[model samples]
Target: MESAPAQPGTAEWYLAEASKLRLTPLDDKDADPTQDPKFQERQRKIVDLATKSVALTHKNPEKKQQFEVSARYLLDARLQLAMTGDDEQVELLYENARAFVKRDPASHAAAHGAHTLVNLAYHNATQEKAPDKAATWRSEFAQLANHYLQTFPREEPRSVPLAYTAGRLCEQHGQIDDARACYTQIVQFTPDSLHGSEAERILRRLDLVGNPPPISGPTLEGET
Candidate 1:
């Protein structure tokens, strides 16, 4: 069982330690380290403290920064834990992350929502427990990825990753056209970059190139 919430310092230490623990293949291990009963209880303690920190600090913008970071980490831990077994908690975590993203779009908090959704989608898709849930997560991930790309400045450094994620999510959701658009945006934004190259590869694989743009822009290998 989780211990009582500690003060910020102790809570931070515990959360940090938990993050550092290495996870092995599930079949080889007795349990996911994060979902080990002892670890879960310990993480719950940190979550309690982190929740308290957010409530106490949210009104003060400067102070809110630290606790907001804590809140994201705590919720991420819970999301990971929920994915180990409980679908209901997984939904709850999704809501919490979504609420945080809506409340603070510019902050890094929003990315956690995307990350959690992607993880859940991967879990449900590969585990074969709930195909509907998997579909929902993929749809949600695509929506969030598109939203992030639209909301952020195209030239922003984060846009590159967002574009890459959007491309993958769109592809996974069978929005092939949108995936092509995302990959094309990546190439346009950063032609020589790794993500651009990867996007080009996917475009080639998908045979997304058509009669060409007529202006004769950059062409991936094997493109018409």
Candidate 2:
């Protein structure tokens, strides 16, 4: 009983602390029809299970496989939390994901990390609601993203995410042409994955926003 409290230290408190921390995980999502009560319940169960599974990951070599599963689980949970608007849980889940990635090679994490930072930064940049810490998170997220780009080099599948991250960073920083450039690159390089759809959507968004003059040339990876 002692382990639990009436929301004893609900994950909310850590949101600020976590935000201030050096590493914040990325954001992603799940299917909708999430408005249904039953579906919502199911989602919560899945999140709980995912949280537990991640909690069980061991550092030992024999348990290395579990670590990967756990990292992925946390990633899924982060997506779910974002959908439900539980930003605190999203942040906490991100911490777990980052810690997990550090333990091993986070294949998709580099991109995912960039994704979260962009969301955080974009929200901050919004006209109506830039919270006090918004700039901090925006900067922090950009650094993490640059770290990913620098560390990972080029993989055929990863270009779209990299493009998205770069585009979001440019948008947040007010580099409209740079943003257009990144999105255009996504259109060219990431034409296969789910990111391809995202790339198209972003291109549409850029058009709507009237960025004008898409940026051109090879991606940071040079597509070699």
Candidate 3:
């Protein structure tokens, strides 16, 4: 039988539990759990737990850096949860992301936290019903995506996803040239990799044959 959900706990306990969840695979029986509601629920729960853990670390300076790392995990998991289109849940998740950034501005944590905001903004634009709000979110996404791409360390392995995210954000906002540049970087940096393959598909979709139109001297605000 499956186990019952855990009760919320102190920072140390929550952090430990979240760490275990992070290390564990979603399910051994299912080859892919991406579409599994149970998987998502579990992920959401784990992220919530992580947020609680972050809360406990607020007063401990030694744990502040650790909170940054946990925030990344929390934000990613929260985004996954938000994909279910649970509006109330998404609102809380957004707040959680905001709290994460406010708590720690460490570069690594901030990068991941920025990615979380991008996901929320994109979700608002594409999935929500409010046009004005959607436009606002898209605008935010564009700025966040650009900043993430520009600031993240190019040599780090983590740059792959950040670049891909920037490309997708540009594509969604109709900044074709900027999107292409970001995608092209992924391809050039790691041609045979997953992100590179996805980037190539985006380029093909944009119908650009060569060099992505040169990014065009900044000012990559996208169409609403």
Candidate 4:
């Protein structure tokens, strides 16, 4: 005999229903999925199901695995919505990411959360229209990048990229000291890596300011 479907309001039911929605995967780099009404509808349904699943399993000690899965779904949904320019969803994404970190500072989830914050910071810096808002996000990015470097070991895969981004952002914003610190960390930890090499070059450039030229040669050909 065939098995019966899971009942509504249960974790299994939520997951099953969300899976059946068959929403398009978020992999099309050239198209905006949010611009499609059908896609948006399906996404909203999945988000709702995932949210309910998370709430249902959150306080149940026996449902720890389900809670984690549901949380992942919810976080992913929020991220998608935020990328679609939904301001409310952006706020929720930030909240959920921070909550993950607060729950377990050393967990993989915390690292993922920090990375999510970094993405949002980049979006704000590049996409936000208002100068004041962009400035605020840049400040937050600097703080979060510094926190990630301090909180996670240098061996973390994200450490180098985050350091490089932070350093570049700092340099763009005239935070020379902060930029130097970030570049210094990269050179110290991964001197042979591409980022490290770039950081070293930038450091040399920074150091050259107000100092005599190493060699009084003219600019190289095609090196305006």
Pick the lDDT winner. 4
Candidate 1: tens digits of C-alpha lDDT, residues 1-224: 99765454553444444444423123435666555776666556656655655566555676656656766766766766676677677777778777777778666666656655655554554454565765655555555454555555433466578668767866876778767787887777677989889988998878834544445655687555
Candidate 3 TM-score, true structure as reference: 0.55
Candidate 2 positional error at 129, Å:
9.7
Say which prediction, candidate 1 or candidate 4, comes out ahead on lDDT. 4
Better of 2 and 3 by lDDT: 3
Q: State which candidate has the highest TM-score.
A: 4
Worst 10 residues of 1 by lDDT: 19-28
Off by over 4 Å in 4: 1-5, 21-30, 34-41, 59-62, 169-178, 185-193, 210-224
Model 3 ranges off by over 4 Å: 1-10, 28-34, 119-141, 150-224
Of the candidates numbered 1 and 3, which has the greater lDDT value? 3
lDDT order of candidates, top first: 4, 3, 1, 2
Q: Is candidate 1 or candidate 2 better by lDDT?
A: 1
lDDT of 4 by residue, 104-158 (tens): 6765556666777776677677667887877777767666676676677743478
lDDT of 4 at 80: 63
Model 3: pairs clashing at backbone N, Cα or C within 3 Å: none
Judging by TM-score, tell me the better candidate of 2 and 4: 4
Give the per-residue lDDT of model 3 (tens digit) for 10-128: 66668778778878775566544446877787787788787777777766888876676677778778777776666776787767756655665554566676667666666666665
User: lDDT tens string, model 2, 1-224?
Assistant: 46532232323222222222213322323435234454455445555554554454444555455444544444554555554545676577567546655755444543454455444443443422445454444444444444444444554345346557756866776666666665665566556667657867877876866466667888889963
Q: Deviation in angstroms for 71 in model 3? A: 1.8
